[model samples]
Target: MADAAFTQGAETADRGRLWVVLYLATTGLVLLLMMLAGLWMRLAQSGWLDTDPALFYQLMTVHGTGMVGIAALGGAAVLWHFLSAHIRLHAWVMGANFWLFLIGVVAILAADFPGRFGGAWTFLYPLPASSQGVWPVWAAALHLGGLLVIGVGFLIWCLELARGIIATYGGLGRGLGWHVLFGGSTKDVPPPTVVAATMVAIVTILALIAGATVLVMSLINLAFPSVELNPLLAKNLIYFFGHTFINATIYMGVIAVYELLPRITGRPWKTTKVFLAGWTLSTTMVLIIFPHHLLMDFAMPVWAMAIGQVFSYVNSFPVLVVTGLGALAILHRSGIRWDLVSTLLLISVFGWMAGVIPAVVDATVAVNSVMHNTLWVPGHFHFYLLLGLLPMIFAFMIHLVRVEDVTPRGGDLAAILYLLFGLTFVTMFLVGGWASVPRRWAEHLPEWQIWDQIAVITAAGVITLTTVFVAMFLARTPAMLAKG
Candidate 1:
């Protein structure tokens, strides 16, 4: 009976592994397509591509929504793949979320393309309903409905993870090592993966709830023009949901660094009290920091904005400092061999840390007054997502397909190229932000076109390298799956 139970668990792990590979493949394909859309926008801004203004916004809508959605899905894959080792998770939950996610993607694409709904990804309250004649009511409803579908899928995913963690660890607090941190009990302290997963599950569940509330109310408002929501309330909910959801992706993706880095360096990433405290601090602060996104709105409560500003400074440090120092300490005397995975993982640490500087800068009320509407916003997020989160996801993919004595051809070159051009690309956005170039504009002035043009060229390089990475993953996926 014990042997049979072991066999069953192995089979379950194999099935989960297969689904994770599929999730990564989907994520790679979508990421490549989104990069193309972003490149096209840059080209249009540089006057190299003749895109219709409507199409540009449409592409912007799809690109933003698609990238965020795929990031969450990919992050879930990373979280589940590693967390499963510590706790039993249902493979069917992963499969169910995948199908639901695909369904949501289809609905969103149809709404953006044929339906012509382009109010931007935020879909901000009345904007979806107030598109004039650019799009019909059905388009707006479909778009909102699609988002609702996606949120539902992710909600289930987070819940399943939470359920697993709670069942295994006795409670979410214990999963986060709170007992070890506070109660001073050393027994059964959860690893970094569980602590991270616990944090993600708590925050993501809250984010999705906030997201669903606003989405449903907006859909109702759309269906009945008289049923209205306060614009400020809507903005708060939207940004809260949006900011938390996106930030949670980084937390989820960082698990790869935590789990894989020590393995590569022949070091153990133990969950000390410091690590637990760092995550605990971040888990609270990340939920409260979204108000920084609304700093420009005078209608928001002064206390909320203050919380946003203060916590923005505080939130940027805790987990990052702990993780950064942890990585360095582990690698210091480990004599680890530098490969594509290790290189990218280390770079992700730097990118995540560096990205926070600009984000915190913008989160300041005074600086946000000037830079909030500029390209600085995108620069800050793209810095982390492109350079930080993508590398983590990419490293995990390569790790999955990696074999002993078989080096991936040109893998290191592709990673280097990605980093170089990604830096240049995001730097162009920062430069443009310093020049006060407004973001989400379909066109740019002559002086602004230079930065856009440079960004266009750099974006092409980033996209090309990303394609190479994705192709490498795709080629090896079959073998990886078969081995599973």
Candidate 2:
């Protein structure tokens, strides 16, 4: 009976690994396409290519929406693989989510390309309706409908994950290590579980509801032209949803680091009282911090804006003090080999930390009033997403594939080039932002063209190096899996 039980568990693990591979492959593909779309927009801005303004915005919409979904999927893949080790999750549920997300992507493409719906990814209320003959009302409805389906899929996944955690660990507090935080027990909770629990708890309630509200309002407005919605209310809900969704990506990435880094370093990153405290604080701050994005809205209450600044300031401490310090300590003189996973994960910590600095600065009311609409906004997020988040996603994938050697051919060069160009590209945006260069412009003035030109070049290099990295992984994956 014991042997049979062990065999059953092994089968479940195999199934989980298979799904993780699928998720990673799909995410990489989507990211590649989205990167190209973003490059096209930048090239147009640099005067290297002539693109119609409408087409430029359509590409922007696709890039923005698609990249967020891809990032979420990459993070979810990491969490799903690690969490499956501790709890039983239905493979079919994850598979359904994947299919729904793909469908939504296709629907978005249809809305943007043929239908010419270019309201941007936020699909902010009234803009979809106010497309001014750029797109039909039905196309707007279809776009929102796709998003609604995606939201429903995400909601269900979070709900199932929440349910599984509760059933396996007794309750949310137990799973989240609240007992340890309160000095009640230092028992069985692991850091990854705390991440999973906190993320699921916050996102299940906040992101899904915020997403549903915006999508529903969009569909209603599309269906009933007479039914108008408050613009301020819609903006608030949409940004709340957007902020929470992206924030959840980082949480999942951090959870992956917690689970995978220890294995590479031959160290045990056990859940501690302080670590649990950070996550608990994160649960509250992440939800409320959305207000920082809306600080430019003079109509928004001063109290909410104040809350945004305060929480944004406080939110930096956990990642910097706890996760960053803990990672440094783990890597310090551990005799850890600088393998692909280790190298990428270590750099990802820096990327995340550096990205947060700019984000925190921009979150300040004074800086935000000037920088919010500038290229600096993209500079910070792209730094975090491209430098911080993508590397973590790749590291997790490499871990799953189990590359036997630390040194894949050309990997060292690829990593160096990727970092060099990615940093340079983002720096250009930051400098441009500092110069008050506007964002979301299809064309740039002569004064801004030099920055865009440098950015386009650096971006191309970054994209090329990323392709090399992906290609290296693909080349190694077959051999690694065969060995297994």
Candidate 3:
């Protein structure tokens, strides 16, 4: 127990912290850019911006690509820190992983400018393959190539981590992670969650491989001109990749919760049991939920739909039960200190809860009918993304950095204001979604105009509140970086 802190190596913290700082700052830059694009999109639709769709798609494409690339796999670089610091693993391959990740991000961004690939990040076929006799098809190929390289980087880092665990557990009968969690000697290995993370990495590798294969084929067809595009195969491959990749971030978020939540409140999570079991559950169920994306398309059979919904409902249970509620349990047991990280964690729980209700209801055969493509879809995602993943990322950033970690003196007031702001976003999205308001629409029917106004007003509130918070953080960040 005395060595628990040291178990997370000292030098690794400094090294890992730099990566975290880069990741957090880059992610912030991406979000700031996205919000600007979103504002522009709003303006253009209202005829306020007078922008062309091509340029709009360029910004949107970069924004989506950047967020997904980092938000999803940023944790790949981060996993090195988790291993080296907490598990006392070697860092031989960490920097190498970062280099590859950077290469992929740079390549995709370069190809996305107006000349080569205005295909948008979705790369939604046929259009991406053709130029309208205007732009060449090579642009699509370039984007896929970038994703391929990033996937390779993720796999290499995972392998390095697994090897470290094997080294620590040479003769021990217990799992490596079990040894670490129970306060075993330096010779003992990491706990179950860490061990499960290796397996999650394996799943991510396969999903990406599947996606890259189909994407590459589509690109190759452009040159070959005779290759057939199988819609079924393409859809399956992309979702398999998309679902797993997005969930990868959630996996890291979950791990962070188990590791950091207890420490913040001076709580002990058995350091022994829940961490291992919870992650094991996550590894198993998460694989089955990918089919939910296909539910909107009717090409699949009823059995497929039923099975998808069932698994979709079931898959998130582990996360909702073990990580979400469990966080509060530990905090309740330990007494809440209400720090910035703690506040983010608390909000993550609420966000997860918010996502779960609509999601569970929509999973039902009856409700899925009304909620399938409407504003309800956005309703669920905002809660999931804004409340769940976004806050989770914020919590991770705080833990991963050294910015005083202080909430303002009036943070409780800030929390109330922020919560109301988020709720406004959720509420408007729900109203529009229920009214069958089509999303990504520039303007709507006269009846929908009121909902649109509500949406704009709420979104404006969110933008205002978020900008304030961001400015505060940015103000502090330069000083924090200066310290380093």
lDDT of each: 0.92, 0.82, 0.64
Report the lDDT tens digits of candidate 2 across residue range 318-407. 755678878987888899877677778877888898998899999999999899899999999998888888888887777766645656
Count the clashes in each prediction.
Answer: 0, 0, 6
Q: What tens-digit string does per-residue lDDT give for candidate 1 at 1-484?
A: 9999998999889899989999999999999999999999999999999999999999999999999999998898899999999999989999989988989899999999999999999999889999979988999899889999999989999999999998999999999898999999989999999999999999999999999999999999998989889999999999999999999999999999999998898889989899999999999999999999999898888999999999999996999999999999999989887778888898899889999899999999999999988999899999999999999999998888887635555657677778999999999999999988999999999889999999999999998888877887899888876775
lDDT, candidate 1, residue 137? 94
When 1 and 2 are scored with TM-score, the better candidate is 1
Strongest candidate by lDDT: 1
> Candidate 2 vs candidate 3: which has greater TM-score?
2
Model 3 lDDT per residue over 1-484, tens place: 6587665565566666566566666666666666666656545544545666666666666766666676664455345545555455544455666678788877777777744566655565566677575455566667767777777776676666556655655422234244443555454444535554664565676676776787687768767877868776677777777777766765655555666777787775543355555555556666666667677777877787776788777767765676656676787657676766677668767777677677766666677677776778668766666666666666665555445546666654554566677777677778787887765554455676665555556667666655655565556666776787
The CA lDDT at 462 in model 2 is 81
Model 2: which ten-residue window has the lowest total lDDT? 190-199
RMSD of each: 1.0, 1.8, 4.7
